[model samples]
Target: MRVLLIGEYNRSHFFLKEGLQELGHEVTVIGLNDGFKKVAVDISLDQNYTSGIKKKIKVLLHKLFNIDLHSKSIKKQILKNQSQLKGYDIVQFINESSFLCTPKIECEIFDLIKSWNNKVFLLSCGTDYISIKYAYDKIPKYSLLTPYFEGKGSKNNYQAPLKYLQEDFKKLHKHIYKNIAGVIASDLDYHLPLKNHPKYLGLAPNPVKILPPNPIKEIKGKIIIFHGINLYNYYKKGNDIFEKALEILQKKHKNNISIITVKNIPYNEYIKSFDAAHILLDQVYSYDQGFNALEAMAKGKVVFTGAETEWLSLHNLKEDTVAINAIPDPQQIAKKLEWLILNPDKIIAISNKAQEHVIKNHNYIKSAHKYIDLWNSAN
Candidate 1:
C-alpha cells in the first residue's frame, strides 16, 4: 500500500512513516523536509515571515481574512502532485492543520479528493479545534477571535463581548464534533471529553523509540527547567510558572539546583541534552501530554506536569508514572525535590516504572501498528 503523509517531517512524522514501512507499506511524506531518515517528497508550503512596514498589516490581513493567503500557491503544488497522489492508496494528514496561530484555510485538496472519490484521514497532531473554540468563546467584548475550521459553523475571527460570544461558540462546538470523522488524543483528558461521540478513536501520545537503559548516575542535585515564549501566541509549555517556581527555589536552595533553558534545538540532537538531567518539567496549565514529556519518559527520566482527573481515570495511575504532579506552590515543588534528594531509592523505583510505561505502551513499533490498523480500517 502507498501512503502519503501530509505534515512536516519531524521526529513524530519520521517515526510514523518508519512504523508504516516496518508494517510493509510504502510511505511518502510531504512538506518541508527536515532531512530525517524517511522517504520524503519535498514541497514547500511557502510559510514564511512577512515583514516590512506592512508587518502588522499583513498579520492583520491574515488574521482578519482567516484564510491562508498562500492557499492558492499550496493548491497549485498539490495539483502538480495530483498524479502522484492518485498512485497512493491513502492520503493521511499528520497535522492537517493549516492554521497554526491564525485562521487556516480548508485545503482545496480535500474537495479535489471528493472528485476522485479518494479517502483522507486527518491526524490529531495539532491544535485542538474544540479547545480553540472554548478559548474563542471565552473572549471578552471587543476581543479578537479567529476560527480555524471551515463551513457555516467555522469560526476564525470576531470582535465580540464575552457573554454573547461564548453562547455563539458553545453552540458551534456540538455541531462540529458530531460531524467530524474522528480524533486521536494523546492526553486522556483530551480524549474523554470527546468520548460521547462515536468517531473518537484513541491514539496514544507520540511514541518514542526507547534507547538502551543507561546506568543510573547520581543526578539528584542537578535539575534543568525548559522554557519558551511566543509574543503573538499564548504560551502553553508552562515556562512562566516554572520561572516563578525557580525564583522561589533559588532563594531556598541557592547553589543546590542548576537550571537550564532549552530553546528551538534541532530534532536529531533534541534528546541528547536529557542525558545530563534527572527530571523534565512539562506544561503547567495543560493536562495534556506533549512530545517532550514522552521523549523524556523514553529516556527513563522523571517528568513532572499537571495531573488532570481525566488522565488519572484513563491510565488508572494513583500517582503519575515518572512524572511528579505539578503544584502551584513553590513549597510543594521544593518538597518533592527534597524527597528525591533524601530518597534515591524511590526515584529509582519510579524511573523503572516510567521506563516500563513507555516501552510497553508508547514504543514506536506499537503505535505504528495501531496507526496502520486505523488506516486499513479507514479505507
Candidate 2:
C-alpha cells in the first residue's frame, strides 16, 4: 500500500508515517511548515499543489473572504496524480484543513479522490465550524462573515446575526459529512458528535512516537511548572486564565516555586522539556486531550488538566493514573501544587503509573497496527 498524508509533519504525522512504513507500506508525506524553520525530520514539499499563481490567488482570497475557490485546480492536480493514488491501496490524510479556516479547501480534494474508488481516510484533527456550534452553541461572526467580523460592524453588531450563522454552519456540516469515507477523532470526546453520523468510521487518541522519558533522579529545587502561551493570539485555548493563575501563584507562593513558559521550542526539544519539569499545565475548560497533554503524560510528568466529571465520563477515564484534574480557580491550583510538593513519594508513584498507562494504551506503533487493519478491511 502507498499512502499520501497531507498536512504538516508534526509529532502526529511523523509517528504515523514511520509506523506505516514499518508495516511494509510505502508512505509519502506532503506538508507545509508548521512554523518551525528547520525540522530534523525529512519531509517532502508539494509545490505543485500548494504553489502556482492560481493557488496564490485562492490563498489571498481565503485570507480576505474566508472562502476557498481552488477546488478546480485541486481537481486537476488529483487527476494528474491519479496514478499515485489509484495504484495505492489506501490514501490517508491527517489534519485536512488549511489554516484559513475553510472546509471547502480539503472537501474539494476529497471529492476528487473519492471518485476514483480508492480507500480514503480523513483524520479530523480539530473542530470544524459545525462541531464548534455543537460544543459552544455559537460560531464567532468572523468565520462566516469576514468583512463584518474584521470591520467596525464586528465591533458594533452583525448584519446577518446569530440565526444566519447557525443555519450556514449546519448546511456545511450536512454537505461535508456526506463526502468523507471515515472520521477519526483526536480524542474520545471528538468522536461523540459523529458517533451517530453515517460517515463515522473509527477513532483514536492523537498518536506519538517517542516513549516517556525513563525514570530519572528527581531534580532538587522548587516545584517547576510549564505553561505554553502565544501572547499574539487571544482565543479559546484560554491563555488569559493561565496568566491569571500564574499571577496568583507568584503573589501567594512568593518565590517558592518556578513557573516557565515553553513556547517556540524546536519540536524535538519540546518533548525533553516535560521530562525536566515536575508538573505540566493542560488546557482550560476543555475536557478532551490536547496533543501537548498526551505527550506530557507519556513522559511520566504530572499533568493538571480540566478533567471535569462530565469530561471523564464522556471519555471513559474514571480513575486517571497520570493526570490530575484542576478547576479554573487559581487558589485550587495553588493548593493542589502545595499538596504534591509536600508529598514527594505520592508524586513518584503517580508519575510511574502514568508512564505505564501511556505505553499500554497510546503507543503509536500499536495504534498504527489498528489503522492498517482498518485499511485492509476498507475495500
Candidate 3:
C-alpha cells in the first residue's frame, strides 16, 4: 500500500511511517517540524517566518492590513508539492485542519487529495471539532476546555476550542467528515467522544518505537523526577497541577526527591536530559496516554500520566500497573509522588511494566498492521 499521512503530532506520524515500512508499505509524510520537538517528516512544509521578529511582523501586518501572509505562504507550499501528494492508496489527515492552513485552502487541499485517492481517513489524534464539542457538552468536568469555560484558565487557552465553535471550522469539519472514508481515534481520550459517530471506525493505539529498558542504577540519595513544560499549553496539559504537586512533594520529601523542571527545550536535548531520571510527569487532562508518556514508557520510566479507568478497561490493565494515572487534583498528585519517592522498589516494578506495556500494546509494527486492516476494511 502507498499511504500518505498529512501533518505530524508528537512524532506520531513518523513512528507510524516506520511501522508501515516495516510491513512492506510505502508511506510518505508531510508536516511541520512541530516546534522545538522537531518531528521528522518525508517532505517538510515548515514555515521559516513563524518565529522571532518575523512572527511579530506577520501578526502586525495581519492586524493592520487584514492580510494573512502566513496562509498565503502555506497555500503556495502546498501547491508546490501537490504533484508529489497524488495517487496514494490511502491518504490520512492528522486532524481536520491538518496543514495549519486557512480553511478555504485546507478544503482545496482535501478536495484535491480526495480526487487523487478516495480512501482518506482522519486520525483523531489531538484537539478537534467533535472532541472539543464533546468536552463542552458531555465531559466538562475535567476536559482541557473546562478550565477555560469556567473562567479559571486564560482566554488564550480557549482560542483553539473557540475556533472549533466558529462557523468556518464547523463547515470544514462537515466537509471533511462527509468526504473521508472514516475516522480513527488514536487513543481513549478521542475514542470515547468519537465512538458513536456515524463514520467512526475503531481505536488504533499510538505507535511507539519500543526501546530496550535502560539499566536501573542504585539510588544513593534523592530520587530524580523530571517534568518538561510547554508554557503555551501549560494549563491544558495540567502542568499547573503538576507544579503544585511538585512543590508539595519537594517540601515533604526535601531530602529524598530531586525535582527537575525544564521548559521549551529542543527534543533531542529534552530526551537526553531526562535519561537519568527515575520518573517522568506527563499530562493530566487526558484519559489516555499520549506520545510523550508512551516514549517515556518505552524507555522503562515510571511515567505519571493518564491511565484512567476507561484507558485501563480499553487495554485490560489494572490500576497503577504500568503508568500512574495523574489526576487533576494537586493533593492527589502530591500523595502519589510522595508514595513513589518513599517506595523506590515500586518504581522499578512499574518501570518494567511500563516498557512491557509499550511493547505489547503500542509496538509500531503491530499498529501498522491495524492501520492496514482498517484501510482495507473501509475499502
Q: Give each model's whole-structure lDDT.
A: 0.55, 0.59, 0.85
Off by over 4 Å in 3: 138-140, 215-218
| Residue clash pairs of candidate 2 | none
User: What is candidate 2's lDDT per residue for 245-333, written digit by digit as tens?
Assistant: 77777776656678878666666667666556777886654555567777787777777764656555754665444577755556767
In order of lDDT, best first, we have 3, 2, 1
* lDDT string, candidate 1, 92-128, tens digits: 6554343222122233455464344345666655444
Clashing pairs for predicted structure model 3, backbone only: none
Task: Rank the candidate models, highest TM-score first.
Answer: 3, 2, 1
* Clash numbers, per candidate: 7, 0, 0
Q: Pick by TM-score: which candidate is best?
A: 3
- Residue 335 lDDT, candidate 2, scale 0-100: 71
Give lDDT tens digits, candidate 3, residues 1-379: 8999999987899899999999888899998767677877889885856789988888998789976676778778877988888889899999998877667778887887788775899999888899988888856357787567657667877786668777888899999999989999999889988877889888899998877666344667779999999887888888998999998987878988888889988777777778888899999878889998898888888898888888788778898879899988999999988888888888888888888889999999999989888777774
Clashes of 3: 0
RMSD of each: 6.8, 6.0, 1.6
**Candidate scoring better on lDDT of 2 and 3:** 3
lDDT of candidate 2 at residue 146, scale 0 to 100 = 30
